[model samples]
Target: MKEKGFRYSILASGSSGNSFYLETGEKKILVDAGLSGKKISQLLAEIDRQPEDLDAIFITHEHSDHIQGVGVLARKYQLDVYANQKTWQVIDQQNLIGKLALEQKHVFECGKLMTLGDLDIESFAVSHDAVAPQFYRFIKDDKSFVMLTDTGYVSDRMSDLLANADGYLIESNHDVDILRAGSYPWATKQRILSDKGHLSNEDGADSMLRTMGQKTKRIYLGHLSKENNIKELAHMTMTNHLLKADIGVGQEVKIYDTSPDNATPLVTI
Candidate 1:
């Protein structure tokens, strides 16, 4: 029998690596495969899934933390990989994930909708440092989930595109104060705080306030920097913002934290 609802899990999320798993009863897919194949497989096992069960992998960019295990997983499972042409080009140029079979390489245009099994998937461009970093939205029936991470800032268009999602896996990469005072070099800090860099917790909170609606109840704060942000801080940052907007956390919306080493519990909507 087919599953009755959409379900997903953040297999791993952070600067060290990133990956997400989603299933629509008939199809199982991974959004990124940044960790080693063995590590990804182990994470999958925690969720009662196997790497071989994936039908495809959708790449967001050529960053090593997002595509590290893509080659191995795709080659081992003969799974298709989808990415924008520019991202594909850099991935190939850098040999980031190693060789992928011609058949397994699939180029998708951003801002276009593609259907896969029971879901409708769409990718939209984001303000990130990478050549072609885009975030994704997945719709199954009336339930929609937005995966918006790695972006330095959320544009107005992105905010509009993500409104009223049922769930969001958004980046709350760092705290501005914490990042500004961290041990990193000045240039690195500046890069991280740039328009093409990762979003600060304040930026993320504001973005959520702009995009979240009555239908948006669940949010998974992702891509937190261990050097600059704490899990509790990210959660509190969003929670406090929501409260100020007269939105109830846990009552009206539930916020979850994702980890670099652990898989979040399976979330269904």
Candidate 2:
């Protein structure tokens, strides 16, 4: 049988910015708009989508790398922007971002399920330093999809929570050894290794192994560190660990790396 409706594209992902386009065959939504407004618009056009075509924009947290273009996107598209109350408060307190219209504001509580078009979307809390760090779980036609980024470590509960996704975009931020020896300051290193910081490549790969099932077919490694991790290193780390665990990546799962400067090709699930 043909796969039911789902298509995903990562526009940009890294310390610089992050965003994605998710379509449920009927509905199109942006997970985040971290790059500049003009940049995001151009990226959308690259994929044959326009700002006005979005159903909504969901903000994962208040970090500048995730919210830099949120206000600008909302203003331009008059798009519905959803975030947890705490994240909204934090974003509003920062005047660097442009203004969003009153009608465009929407608040969502973590773990509370909501819907956009035919897809059921649930935002769950994640271990990140942001005030209300969360990631999404979207279900459509019984197919589960998730996008997790900027997470420090994976908890057992989180692993179980994410299992059986048809597609997942998970953060593999850095290599622990490289990060330790890298030029970033000691304090910065500590933060990246902290429970509430970013996920090391090992941690990310292990989470994938734990959570993946036959239904879990597509894995996109995202939010890699520029200073501490290269794309080849991150990809190799994940593939090697999976092979050691007797889970062959190319056999039952397909893996890809997200881009820091461009959009990945749209892959339909």
Candidate 3:
């Protein structure tokens, strides 16, 4: 029997690497390829999927943390890569080295809608240090999902784009108090706290609250720092704020965390 809903999984997530798998009955798409091709293959194997099952990759930006394995995955697996023109320039200048070109890498402009296999994708600009960082809204049949990570701040524009998503993967990068007392260098600390750096727990919670509604099903917090925040604290911070807004946990919506080292179970719609 065919499954009633779309399926999504975080192959791995963190500063070391980031990758996600999404399947909509007939089509499969990977959101990012941060891990090595070998590691990615292993992760897929753990979930009973093969590398060849992937249809394409949607890059949020050109950051090493998100594209570390992109070139290798695309070249070896012949997976189509999609991103904006600026991302392409940055990707091209980077040391792809001996990695396979795969073929002409596909390009799509931010704020435009496109079709990938049987799924629909809408790209939007997001705040970050990388060239043309973007967030994605994906639709398949009647289900809608969004992936908005690597963003420094939440904006009205981003809120509008993510509104009413059935599933969301958003960045919750740090805890403010922890970041203030952490031992990192002053310059690096400043960058992380800046508007173009990373999202704080509060920032992430606020964005979720803005998009919270009866229809939103799941929210997976992503890209948390190893040094500055603890998983429980990050979850509590967002949880408390959302509760104050009268968003009941496991009632109106479900919240999840993506570990920095490995994959989470497939989050289905």
Candidate 4:
């Protein structure tokens, strides 16, 4: 059965910035705040939410695109900010987000489950070129949602932990061919294609196949590359691959596209 008032939305996604919103009837939280505080607030307003309504902000890593607005929002709203210790170190060393009050800082260990209001949340390590990068799984009642992104490859443990999720916001970052032949510097290209880089469309599809199960239905393709991927190509790549495996794209699972410039409609789970 679906949990009432349980919903998730991608506030913004892509190489430029990323943020996600998740809510239960009693609580609201943000997964990241990469955009400026003003921009994030505007996006929240589009979804009939405000920064002050959020209970916490979770950090995936110290990458600027994943943490630009974190300190600003945390200070302005007095929201708790959670990150693994290593990630916090880099953020502090670089002053990436700015000053965060001691009271607003919360450190979490990967693979541990944390309870906040009506949600049970867990974070797991992912292979990425940042200090302690990770993704999250959120559970409410019997429904589960996985926010899996910013990883070049899915680890065996990640697949095990992510299995049978009801909804997924997974990375479909680039197309291999386009990224290989594009105008990016050779070093940049190599990094993106490396095991610790971002996932290509094909890799993303394969990872989804490995993790999705009977209860999986909703999929949102996120963190697309502005240069190496287009929404249609990423969507079609996953759809065609699923079809080959006898999984009906529209019938068995509904796929949604996220944007770097706007927010996706809040989807109930």
TM-score per candidate, chains pooled: 0.98, 0.96, 0.94, 0.97
Stronger candidate by lDDT (2 vs 3): 2
Candidate 1: C-alpha RMSD to true structure equals: 0.9
Q: How good is model 4 by TM-score?
A: 0.97
> What TM-score should be assigned to candidate 3?
0.94
lDDT of 1 at 153: 89
Candidate 3 at residue 165, lDDT? 85
Considering every candidate listed, which one attains the maximal TM-score?
1
* lDDT tens digits by residue: candidate 2, 1-269: 64586887899999899998888766888988889989988888878888888878999998888878887778877789999999888888876456777788899899889988778899999989989898898887888888888888878898888888898888899988899999999999999899889988888988888887879878899999899888998899888987898776898887898887888888777
lDDT of 4 by residue, 7-96 (tens): 888999999999999999778999999999999999999888899999999999988899989988999999999999999998888888
The lDDT values for all models are 0.92, 0.86, 0.81, 0.91
- For candidate 3, list the clashing residue pairs, or say none: none
List residue ranges in candidate 1 displaced over 4 A: none
Candidate 1 C-alpha lDDT tens digits along 1-269: 76666999999999999999999878999999999999999999998999998999999988899999999999999999999999999989888888888989999889989999888999999888899898799998789999998888897778987899999998999998988888999999988999889988989999999999999989889999999998898999999999999998999999999999989988788
| Model 4 backbone overlap count | 0
In candidate 3, position 34 carries an lDDT of: 82
